[model samples]
Target: MRDRPVPQLPLALILSFLAVSGLLLLEDLFARPFTFLTGISFEAVRRGEMALLLGLAALLAARFVRRDLIHGLLERRAGKALPHLIGDVASLFVLVVGAAIIMTGVYGWDIGAVVAAGGLSLAIVGLALKDVILAVFNGAALNVENAFMVGDRVKIGEVDGTVVQSTWRSTTILTKARRLVTIPNIALGTASITNFDRPDKSEQRVIEICLDYDVTAESAERILLAGVIGAAGISLVDAPRVHAIRLDRDGVVYAIRYVIANHDLGLSSDHAVIKSILAHLRDAGIGVSYPKQEVVTAERRIRVADRTVDRRVLVQQCELFRGLPPDVQARIAEALIEQKVQAGAALIAAGAVRSSLFIVGEGLMKRLRARPDRPGFVEERYVATQAFGRRAFLSDLPHPAPIGAVTQSLVFELTRAAFAGILAAHPEIKVPLATNLARSPTLDITHATEVSALEARAERPVAFYLSLLDAIASSEANAR
Candidate 1:
């Protein structure tokens, strides 16, 4: 709103009115004194009064020309408010035309003589202030063409920044390095500008990464897309995407593309997206590939940790399986399958029976449980290494609520028969787990609670373990 016409309008009109009144009242008071002092007739200089009156009227017309003619009428037709310089130019034109009318029309002055004198004066002033005049007109032209506006991120020549101010003389910008830069309007008019801001439109940014030759392009692209799908400051609804751009010297180059809501958050948004990509790659045990030129004296090998290793680690860390034999647990870990869920996709559906258990490998899941009092649902979350579907797998109950992926995630699925097959093959495996469960005060579960006929004494914990496993296995089979 800087240089807008409203503030100066009233002041211009008030000054014009005061000038007209003062000239009329002071004419009689100074006319006799002028005749006595200088011996020049008052009638001769009275035409000067007419000239002054016309000049005051011209100034008033100039203000109206600036506000209503240029700003209100022309700008409305142009779709956006143009640079203030255009209004100034139009107002100056009005003032000059009003002067020409007062001089030639009223006095019948010699047109050729007046033109010669005015032309000489204009040439001298124009030469002295050539750059200033050009800059003003350049600013007007830039606005007429609908160039970048204030707060728009632009790259004018080598400078990349947001336009903080646009004046007739220059455009000032706040750079990414946190410095202010001023680009003269003359230079700006000639320079190529890249405007990153567009009306009602968001921009898509691409992040490029290289991976080693051993890694499949499909898997890398999948992981990269997963990382960006729900990254902070990205447009999730726009559908972030990935592509295998090309084959590089050491590996395949991938481009992950995502939409950004605003251009001003460039640094923070990129930081978040890059951080997420690194995290997913780290969790998957994949190392980022750099330009490889180093010659090895010995053939050095870099090993990527397998998903089987991740499954075993999750199994060993789980409280439910901690007391089981290490070998038996390893076998159960081997039965796990990799599962992937996209952001906002449903992992578990309400009223659906689940026959497999899920352990989060990376990222997050949100459980939407209906609130006791509210009309809508509330959220519960599960992160890396946490598992779900215990009740469904153990007791064959349909899911009470839906579980959705909060971010693109990796999960390990354990089929219903994963534990049951292991127990049937090695029945002795249940002994250690049952003994540990009976000894722990925090784990008060027993077969007696499940079936009143079964005596759940500590001396016979193996019988309880067998019963528990059998019931769980049967429930899972029925659900399947």
Candidate 2:
């Protein structure tokens, strides 16, 4: 980072002294020669020297006042730009006064006449540039009030953006779309302005979502809260909140409010929150409400299929069981046990031995992993036809993550014992199953080793059964 420049009194004094000396030297050299040629006389040269000396002295004095008094006082109390602005205005005032004094005292001009003429000229100029003058005053007011600063996100009338520049004439804003807008200071002063980064850069953002009436308000709130909390760049100090603010014709409206760490992250945070909410709702089998009107005139007929055929269809829909032969697929489908899990139920916990592969038959489930930094969970959504726990079931490893039901769900579980019995009775199926398992992205040999080590230290029956499954899978892989 660049270091701040410090004022040097000795340097200013030396420069001032050299300027005065140069003026005196010019007067001595030109006074006699000019008087002899032009008849203007030596007195005029002396007067010019004095006038120059007065102006130089005023400039030197202004410099000293700014560096020694004004700057020191304002630097700490006001912001970085305000101190410089005050100093510049002060210096200009001193220089203007010094010029007036030089015209009256040195050249012997009438003070009253000068003041009257100057006042009239100023009045005419001010009238011609009234808008400009108002802008200057408005800018000064903004600086004094500390209304907003560069990099602050602000809304002025219809324009909303971060302040890129603030000047006496106009303030420039860089919008979210990357468009630059310049608004006159006077207009900003007259219009209502909202500063999102005032006092603190942290800002609260609200995300409104409409959910069907089928979802209870309490359940919606829980889902919304779970989505926002622990989101990247969101403020954790303030707890995230959800409110069922309105019940409209289409559905109930929910507002999810959360704080972002900085105004700059507002857009990204909003996107993340909305994405999370959608994922959560989808995982919970909840649908957003939309206007729909339907009429039924005839009775509907329902058809029931064979249980084994339904199970086979559900298994085949999953990518994990896609390429298996018909006979093998049928045998696997026969081994699956249909299970129903209620909402908010844990299907699997992290670091626990998982002996079964679960495929979603209906409804939704979510995979959650414990956050290392805090006592919270990060979730991933799973819907119908999705399969989880493939790594643990295939490699005989402990689950490295947890799975839970976000809503009441129907699932089909194929346990290691059930599959092992099939594989033992017909060893030919082991090679193809092992080949599919080996191709799985979740398969990790290291994870299997870690699970084996953990199981060897425990006397759990599940662990012993997992060891037997691991031996069978290893034999199949070796045979290949």
Candidate 3:
């Protein structure tokens, strides 16, 4: 390397120099008599050195400002780092004072009397601010002890809010309604602080549901578990078990032991679990205890498409369908076939023909499939009750997936062909279906590869296509 370039001085340093020069120029103008009386260059040298120190001070202040040191210090203190902050400020003050002393001493001035007087004045000031001094000491002690941090939801006596700031003299709390209250640190440190966010060995949420004592505990438990699992932001980290604590005057009290995700509101999870439970109980002829009494004569059961059931009871059980427009649900009900999947049966096979969509009425199924890119791929899946599949009916293809019974599964099967015919027969249904499948293909076909596999997999084409044919035939029959 031929030569290294020197870095340019900062603008702050240049401004500092200008300020110091102005101070020195002003001193020179005022100290003319002192300069002549001294017979020495004291005035000139003092002016020069004082100018330098003033420039240095300006430079230091500018550096602090640019670095955001003051801002950070204030924020840290506000965020309950007061003791550490106070220590930092004290250290900086001492260093600056020491430097000033050294600079003054070097210029042949006596510092002993000045230091003694300063100490005396500081002691007198501290006595006057006894409460403030005590508060600062308390803050320092609290910082050393570190009783709590910012963002902690705390309660002290009647007060409750998040710890927003802890300063040398006071601790500030921001309440839920965005109100700020300052408590002197001396008082704050002495008070009992209850930190809500503190980690506990066991955490539980209590959900109070008053169901009639006539309802079995088992049913209540099932309902509670469903609600907990369905709610979003709910962590089943703990066994989501419900305990029947007491048969209070109100009803059966259930303490639902549920963990939420890190202090988040789990209203969705709660709602889902509760809804599922209530639906299940209603199906079982159990009712949730609410302050009400009503009596109505049982509606006469009538045979609709060879199945006799109360329409009102059916409506109440399927709350999921309740959200559907009355007309749409009526169409679905009309198209719905009472198809059943027996215990240990093959409902649908992966990579086979598809025809009807099946919605679970009862029981569980295991879904199996290969994991792609794995050596010697294998199938795996576990599905419970309330699962639905529509690809088979829609595509008119071989089951594109396989479902095996874990337990006997009863289901409502909607055959695509049957649904279509039902729509055509019932002009009212035509509008909605037409709207839903507006862009859908008129006909769905199976993959050639799956078609070939179907004959090999089953004894006959008819046997393999029983489900698909059944669906189509039902739809055709409904239309007729």
Candidate 4:
């Protein structure tokens, strides 16, 4: 991949050769002309050539020192390599030593005597560049301590971002907003820095929510935990924590904390958790509380549209009934039992056989998986317009998980007996219904191995429904 072959001679050797050649060429071309025009001696030309050689030698020595002392050792260690600041300091030391040798050997100049004479001037310059000196020292300390490295996500005072570059002068940070911030090394050394990507790249984020006073601590915790588990980007290795921090006049405060595998995903993960929590609460018919002013309010009767018309509209929106004819849709709607469920009520118990599908009309519902070993439950939330209990109704299998209400909810319940009667009366819709069910992600035949075994004993229609239910249950298990 390299354009040029590796040099046989060292870089210093090559540099020395070039320096000598250039000096000889310069002397040959200009030495006699300058001696004649300016009446200067040839000896003066030799001295100038010697000084140029000494300067070149010093630079060459510095390069060798830098490569040997820093780059050479660092490259071999890979990720454990030391910072460039140390190499820079080592290179500078080499240059200073080289200069001292040049001064004393070439010109018979005493370096100590020169420094002694310019001590006052040196002090003035040192004072002027105090900040730069301090920064360099701080950078050195930081490198030695191994505080943080490039690519680390850190919060240093008001600036928060991933470190792009770290040097003797400053540390560069690239923020989420795409802004680049350069912080002086001295400032970084003095300030308190929180490194999210250090030790490990995982970070814990807290999602705070306020719920109505009616929600119990146990139910609230269950809902919060379920919401966190359902959210993507959350760390499954660590169980999420929910705390009821305070109770106010308006509501109860909850803090849901979970670990995210990546520090960069903190904000997005929090958003997902919030969305999931809201959905779960809505499914359970739970409402969030907000501060409101009290007034002498009077109850007034409000006019609403016909229940049959509303149910027909809802059935039209449902995926299962969407493709059905208008008359079939009306028949399904008529069979639906409109029920109002209170918060904390169980809609369906785990392992209980059910023959009805429940469609959410308003509010939230949580599906909880019983964990006998843990003494608590794992939950998933469904919101408005969503449907559950399809597998139980279709296959006549026990409910995979218990469904509970988080808030006061309104739902339309459709019994399998009612649906079966409709199917018997109109056999033309059976094929269409089966076709639609076949396409569902939760009803893939490949995942329903258990249902295949049951097919030998049960009738064709019954076996198909059982397989679909098994597939749905398998999918839910895999999701968790």
Candidate 4: clashing residue pairs, number: 14
* Model 2, residue 62: C-alpha shift (Å): 6.9
Q: So what's the TM-score on candidate 3?
A: 0.50
* Model 1 bad stretches (over 4 Å): 1-27, 60-82, 110-113, 116-130, 232-237, 290-326, 333-348, 359-367, 378-386, 403-412, 426-470, 473-480
Q: Assess the local accuracy of residue 180 in candidate 2 as a C-alpha lDDT between 0 and 100.
A: 100
The 10-residue segment with the lowest total lDDT in model 1:
444-453
Which scores better on lDDT, 1 or 3? 1
How many angstroms is residue 253 displaced in model 3 relative to the true structure, after the best TM-score fit?
Answer: 1.2
Evaluated at residue 157, the lDDT of candidate 1 is 96
Give candidate 2 misplaced runs (Cα > 4 Å). 1-20, 26-28, 56-88, 104-113, 230-233, 293-480
Best by TM-score: 1
TM-score of each: 0.73, 0.58, 0.50, 0.58
Tens-digit lDDT track of model 3 for 76-142: 4555333334544555565576466555755555677667768989899988998987887788787
RMSD of each: 8.0, 9.8, 12.2, 11.5
- RMSD, candidate 1, Å: 8.0
For candidate 2, the lDDT comes to 0.69
Task: Judging by lDDT against the true structure, name the best candidate.
Answer: 1
Over 4 Å off in model 3, which ranges? 1-18, 21-67, 70-124, 142-159, 194-204, 232-238, 264-285, 290-480
Model 2 lDDT at residue 387: 75
